[model samples]
Target chain A: MTTNHTNHRTNSSGPPLIQCRRLTKTYKKGDNTITPLQELDLDVPTGDFLALMGPSGSGKTTLLNLIAGIDRPSGGNLIIGGTDISTLSRSKLADWRSVNVGYVFQLYNLVPVLTAYENVELPLLLHSMSAKDRHEKVQTAMQLVGIADRHDHYPRQLSGGQEQRVAIARAIVTDPTIIVGDEPTGDLDQESAQAIMDLMVQLCEDLGKTLIIVTHDAKSAAYAKRTLHLEKGRLIEAAVLAARRAPLVPQEA
Target chain B: MRLLPFAYAVRNLGRSPSRLFLSVAGAAMVVLLILVAGGFVNGMSRALRATGGEHNVILMGAGSEESVERSEIEAGVPGVLAASVAGVRTRAGVAYVSPEVHVMLPVRVGAAARTTTQSSGEQAAAAQGSNTASMSKPKGRQVMMRGVTPTAALVHESVSLTEGRWPVSGADEVLVGRMAATVLGVAEIDVQVGKAVMIDGRPWEVVGRFSAPGTVVEAEVWLPLADLMTATKRETISCVVLTLDPYNEETGEGADFGDIAAFTKTRPDLELVPMTEREYYGKLANFFGPIKIVAWVTAGLIAVGGLFGGLNTMYAAFASRIRELGTLQSIGYRRLAIVWSMIQESTLATAAGGLIACAVGVFMLDGLAVRFSMGAFGLMIDETVIGLGLLTGLALGVVGALPPAIRCLKPTIPVALKAV
Candidate 1:
């Protein structure tokens, strides 16, 4: 699944799915103003698996949020899927994101009261999909993440790994073009982290979907096709990583 | 967008069950207090208004209703005026006018004596002995007895015989309302069938027991005017009640009692002041106006406190869920929708509180009698009290919810997102 996403990114012609030129975000605290993201330039090509790595306060999450249209850049351009998201109104950007992007948070923000299936079906509520289609899509996403049997289990009832899988299902349930994860495996144990990362990479490669993961873990960064390092609100390096030790090619291929 | 805010709000509340319970309980207490206070005021007003004596207009001797106890006129004035009044409604050509005398007297039961020597020592001796025995024989029980003719029943529509028939002409029979009978610890047969009660040490045969339309009349005892006058032995007349001639529509028909009083002032033969039963009760209500005002003021102040408590709960609830609200906003829910959802939450909470209070109030307090003098009228909780209580709940929901909702929606997305 990972190889197919790398193949699509290597093949797409016109531009990257996410393009940021001189992006800056500033926060005012009392009398002092702090710049979180300063003149950062990055491009995330379609169907690419990119991992952003940085220390705390390095604006790694800010950059990912800007690309996902979850937060606005104080200055400069952010174009995601051909739309200048930085210039779009909050409401308009929200609409754009629901259709084009899905978010997976570190804490697995799965409304604890709702079952795995319902949590995965949350984002689809904004869409015009029929209930049957939504149900099928959610079921397929759950099955793909291998948590189909746990669909009725609440997040509190599931293991950290299973919950993250449900979170991943939710992220990709809409079949969004880009899936953004802010430390998706940060809260999981080693085995759970590996299982979640494996499922995520499988979904990316198998589904031809772009995945951006923000993480400080080198082992987690090792799974991505591209690793972008951020320092003090600016991109320090952008490079393609060596493929996972096990080649992602299907058994038939 | 539609589900996110509510989802988060509900989830956030669920996350901290203790806080949610505390807030809901606090809100419920406030709502309950408002409901009870509102019910109390309503009950008092109904009780006072109920004393209108069923549309019977009392004509005082050239003074006010408050002054009626001190005022007097010729005993034969009612009969003479009944014959001459221009608009008196008649049944079989007999004017439905009856002269009545009202006086408050101290009544005692069992061994309690009202004599000055016995009363002075009674309090000290009773206090030294058992309190229950002293309480059982209440000292100087103030009972308002009305001296009335048989026609008094016609004038006061609420009067009804539950036992023996109305006093036979010239018979020494007395009737009492149900509440009065209950308070006096005498059954309908004791007051109605053929028993007798003491009036100034004279035993008057009880002829009938009656129930009035409202609670105030229930506290009164009725006796034949001549017998009551004979028992007391010094009465001229307290007041005269007369109906106007029904045929003289132009001159006296539909004449307001106040206007009739003014017209009567011009005549030298009679010095009378007239007022409708309602107006008379209104004047009586004036006596308790200050007490009512104080009650309302206290309730209003407490209500404001309760409102603040409710507002605080809602504000805290909304504030803690800013992240969820931002999530909704980012998912395309309008600011108005978020605001509306918060309002709905508040309304729902307060409405639940109101319903609890109402159920508690109805089950425990409805038809509960609270007897206090509002001048001549005696005010209890009734249907009106319940209606006001429910209305108060609705008003609390509206007034307490709107302000916080507006504040919640005013913050921009970036600010709201950062709130968490």
Candidate 2:
């Protein structure tokens, strides 16, 4: 069955918000050299919802991490919003990521001792906003994610779906340009997974946030405007070309 | 800049309550040891230094400069020194020259002849005046006893009759120190005023009790010089204690100790060695140097052990939270931010521990009497001691936590996230 993707209008005049040309990441594990992402090229315009799908060990998370600026590329260029993040210093890259990307995890990596409000306020603390402003922004973000009622509850006190909502609230609190998810719904049940995917879609459509999510579930991918598949360490060309021609559908092999 | 919200560091400590308690306990132990060591040295030094006046001089038998108890000078030495030294202080035309005999005399607590214990049970029994029922024979304990003339009061200003009248001269009257009853082997309530003490098989009436606060004299009993000489059958005194006129800094010529030194040199038959009381006590304090060093060494070794224990605990705690730290890093926190956060957590724990240790020290150790070779001294856990304890706790926090924090945060975000 096919799922409908949002036909959000895009500005085709400007350069894409994110661009990767021959981007690569490799590591030496004892005697074997492992390349998680190699020679990859992609363009993600602002406000685009892109789903990354692949099997285990298929470098899906690696590409997501590189795009989020959490991992540096080993070779080639990764230009995000006209800045080559690949050449930035570690500290500079961290500062760049703080304003440019917000990451959501499958397990909801909220500090266990901090309340939902505190977890959502974490990113805002990196900025120089006044306490009143931070409070306003955190409340707005939590309300938008439908977790405002549980803002005082800790992560352990909330259900899986509620915790995921808090995690999303934390992501968008900084008003970052892109929100990257590494299996954002991997741990939730089908209904909760659909709810999280729908919230992510809302974040993109309503806030103009570029959403890139790593997921293996076809239903989770169907919420995106386009779904791209990676095998081994390279993106499959046929699937990308097909996706460019139409809206998102489950294209898993 | 604010690395992480301080609340983040503070609240993170509550995540592992048991581990936090363990680390805080370790830090507290180190702080306590340092505090106790400082108190020991401070109390002992104060007890020795405060016992003597700077204007007073001591005359002991030659070659016995270390201990007045071992010195044997003729009883007429004080008279001759007072007559010869022009700067010898006199109050109301009476020279402040006190000829004293320092000796150990048997202090009888009960009639049973058994040695007394310092145990609370025995002290309680002694304090209750129940000696008649508990004793079948005389129970005696030897305490440091001083044979002093009345002028001893003028020479040693710290001593004062706290409870009853001072003993009259040439009378079979003895005065006990306020601390004498608390001394081990003599927990006797009978040592107080109006009671009779059996010394050398002779009954001496206890006419008074005295206190010399913060001085070693607080721990000694006093009796008339003639009575003690007759009772102990000794014609010699331990030392001649003399108070001199204060030096005139303006004239540069008054009450010189050089006059007493010259008098000792002329009277070769007396075999007298003279020194200022301050110098004598200074030497005595130096003699206890090894004890002070031992206290310091013990505390230092214990502190090292505590530091390692704290470090190992932080290592394990940080190991389990590597992924969390990585997540923080991925959320745009710099590595230095995480390090600062870790330091803040450790310091907060140790600071809490320091407060606990201060409470323990104040309630448990302050003013608690300890018996040393010279006499007994109460631990002085004053504000200075508490400040030192807190400083030590903070130091332990930084020294014990920073290395492990740096090591744990060394890995990159990707590598750290992959950790379990």
Candidate 3:
């Protein structure tokens, strides 16, 4: 599917922003080895809105988590913005993720005890910015997400949509280069899900953030500029699924 | 790097109020136990040391250095010492040598008074050998009886009459020390001036009350020496106390410690040992030193137990917050930073408990008297004790929380985030 806002304001003239070359992730569970993502190759350019669609156990979230740097790939070179993050130390990866990647969870994983403002301010606390500067950034981020008035409300006090908006505010407060979402609107109502997708579209088109969303909903995927389908930890052509789902042409008698 | 906000750690305590309360209460108990134990040692040591005076000398049986109460000397020893020691101080032309008899007579409160106070476990054990005063109930609490001569007033200047007059010379009158009731674990009204105490099956009226603050003497019941001797049919006395002449270096006529030591050495027939009052009390203090150490050790062991309890609670508490910790780590907080925040939360809980413990100890435990074999002493919760309590609380917090905090945060971000 093609996005309506194809023209972005921020600079997009660059090589692929994220490159995954044979990215693999394997783990052991009680002597049973499990490979979630095996030898996967992918590239996401700057200012691109990409959606990943797959069935259960298809490793969509695993790929998203690896891209977000919360999980490391096994036996692969995963490079983002000219840095081979697979080779970086754990602490160095965390630092890199803090500055370059903003992540949103399906459940809108806001700390229940923290107010919306404090939740939005969490990412900027990693920087050496002054309090005033952090406050301004948090305010701007909350304002951009159109939830500034609900800043003091805790996650439990806010609706699911409002909480997800706070989570998005927290994501962009640091002004990260890439935003990764795992089932971002999975738990929301249809209207709220559409609203969140529209917000993501706006973030990519206006602010030039590279967005990679993992979802199973076709309506959600329609909002992205390009969509990829995966099955059994390996990427497959979307045209194949479209062709299968397309109605058979009938001969006129 | 930036630290985790203080507000986060503090406000998170409200998440589990019962858990927070239990942690705080446990910490407070440990701190209070330490304070009470330390105060006991301090008060007992001070009481023992304060019993001795610099200018007084004690003469007891040669072999009974451990207990003056058990020491026995000839009745004429005081007179012989008075005549032999020339430099002894004379007041109003009379020598200041006092003959004293220390007897541990089993005493019981009056029948009317017995119903008002309950005997402690120790006193009940002591009352086992005695007969019931009324045949309807057990006898009142048992106590130690001290028999002293009139000259004792001059030798121990700390003794001051607080209520009523001193016991008559040859009568069955007795005077109770202010802390005697506490030592006996009886009601204060049971040992007041108007009360009567039965000693050796004979009733002696409480003619007066005396106080010797901060000394073991405050735990004794003082009676006439002649009366106690006649009643118990004892011809021998316990010890002889004497006031020394102020030492004059130039004239060399006043009583010198060297002269007293020589006197004890020359008199082989007397079979007497001479020691300064300070030296006697110093021996008593040393005798109780092991007890002080035992109190501290018990408190330390309990504190260690409290530490493990705190650690377990923290483990569960921090384990439940694994996802929150993962969130912090994913937001770029280092493992050590999260560990520090956990420590801050534990420390804040313990420190709050410490403050409460200190206030409770000072108000409830301080000046509370405890009785032992030798005498009774009040608890001393001074600055040192308070400081010790705080240090214990802080240590409990740090040592207890560190391991759990580190263990909870040990997992990688994805693994921790996966925790429910």
Docking class of 2: medium
**What are the models' TM-scores?**
0.81, 0.89, 0.89
| lDDT by residue for model 1 (B328-392), tens | 56444566666766665666566666677667766775554444542122223446655665666
Q: Tens digit of lDDT per residue, candidate 1, span A1-253?
A: 1111112223357788887777889988899998878876667787789999877988888888778777788998888778898888767777887788878878776666678988888778878878899899999999999999997898889988888889888888888999989899999999899888998898899999999999988899999998876667766533332332346887784
- Compared with the true structure, all predictions reach lDDT values of 0.70, 0.84, 0.85
lDDT of 3 by residue, A1-253 (tens): 3222122122346668888888888988899988878788788888889999988888888888889988889868788999999998888987898899888888888888889999999888889889999999999999888898997899999999998999899888899999988888998999999999999899888889999999999999999988887777777765667776899999899
**Best of the two (1, 3) by lDDT:** 3
Interface RMSD of each: 3.4, 1.1, 1.3
* Candidate 1 residue pairs in clash (backbone atoms < 3 Å): A1-A205, A1-A206, B86-B245, B87-B244, B87-B245, B88-B243, B88-B244, B88-B245, B192-B207, B192-B208
DockQ of 1: 0.26
In candidate 3, what are the lDDT values of residues B134-230, reduced to their tens digit? 3444444445567787778888888899999989967789999888888666789888887887676556789999999888888888898888888
- Give stretches of model 2 more than 4 Å off: A1-13, A239-253, B104-142, B169-172, B185-190, B194-205, B249-254
Give the share of true interchain contacts found in each model. 0.27, 0.63, 0.53
Q: How accurate is candidate 1 locally (lDDT)?
A: 0.70
